[model samples]
Target: MSTSKGSSSRTGSQIPAIGGLDLLKAEINSKHTDCLKLIATNTEGNPSVVRSYISELDNSSFILTWESANPSLNGQIVFDFKKPLSTKAEILNHISGLADSAITDLKSDTKNSVRLEASKQRYCRYRLFNVPGSAVTWFMFAFAYYAKTSTNPISPVSAVLSVASREFFAELFKYAFYFRIFEGIVVFFICLYISSAFPKEISESDVIKWAFSSVLTGIFSSGAIIKLARNLVVSKAKSKKIL
Candidate 1:
């Protein structure tokens, strides 16, 4: 779903939609934001913006994001256009309106309010779900590290706090691994869930036991399975600097 636009692009460009488990086209109507994308990116003297396709939340929605060394050039614009805007002026104005709307709605304590709010919107689920999961994994790692030391007995809390910073970071290092393997793992889990839910002679508990036990064989590894797709890594804005 790379950016494709214009009168020509829109003609060839279709309303690609997902219904049930199949990719299909929706009813042909005037509401097409794909046209807006073509007009802006192909237009001359355009402000460089990264268009990210995030269709999980909304089919018509995509995130218009920008990054600059100049702190003031940042904006977060999520547009799900109900009707097509024809001209370059219309598209640009629409983007401006959306950015202002996002900023106005966003409530933040930081001076860098827009960026902070934008990130919070995009990654709130990650913080809510992933951070706690990472904490548990790191606790296990901390336990392993403490177990090898025969000199003294250490509390679980002490071990976790000692490795607290590395706790989050260690999980981050596996981003590349997770991105590549996400799809396969997801399909595997769906199959497992189905198997557990409906069984003939075998019980649901047996299915669970067999599935997890095979994880040692790397066939059913339970790891990061979120983030269905990712942009290319090399020279990409998100990967340019690793902290």
Candidate 2:
């Protein structure tokens, strides 16, 4: 009886065993190669471990050694064949299938983990402050109003006159100021949500500062846009009356 021993230097407690000496010899002989080697990973655990081999032919049995320190998470079968080179294709196919399945499963698990994290983030945002949805709705309504009024156009001269008029300013102040307050609140909540999403923890003072800055920006933006829109509407109406 002849025997061969293989050894690998890697970190871990577990290692894979060798088997199917008969089949491996036949394949190596048929291929007329000095030796054959194969490598794969075991994917059943939290961190998958690699399994690799260097093989040498003995008279009746082939020996396999593990290149890595840990054994596979799950035990795998060692292919054995009685007939020389008869099952070579089958054995290769089986190994290929195992490798493909392991890779596919790993990719699927990673994708699921990402999706789960995203869901958690969305839920937290909703629970903490549901401002994005409200902001989106408000913007949609404003867009619709603008779209409806845009059909009736006004000249540049009329637009300037409308902005200068006291009546226009009064209406602008009445609606724009209130809308600015709403916009400021929306901005404050948005800033809070964003700050919470960061990995680093923020202090109450920092949050207040963020809110103040964001609200100020929102007020300026909303006030200017609303003022322009109201002025355009007034200009269009005044021009129509004159015509």
Q: Could you say which candidate leads in lDDT?
A: 2
- Candidate 2 segments exceeding 4 Å error: 1-111, 119-166, 186-210, 218-243
Q: Which candidate leads in TM-score? A: 2
- Ten contiguous residues with the weakest lDDT in model 2: 1-10
Could you give candidate 2's per-residue lDDT for residues 87-192 as a string of tens digits? 2233343334444454465553322222222233321121233367447535544543444355553564346445574345434544654565666577567646
Model 1, 159-241: lDDT tens digits are 75466533343344344334324533554475456444422122234444544433332222224311211222222345458
RMSD of each: 21.3, 19.8
Note the residue pairs that clash in candidate 1.
Answer: 5-38
lDDT of 1 at 123: 12
Clashes of each: 1, 2
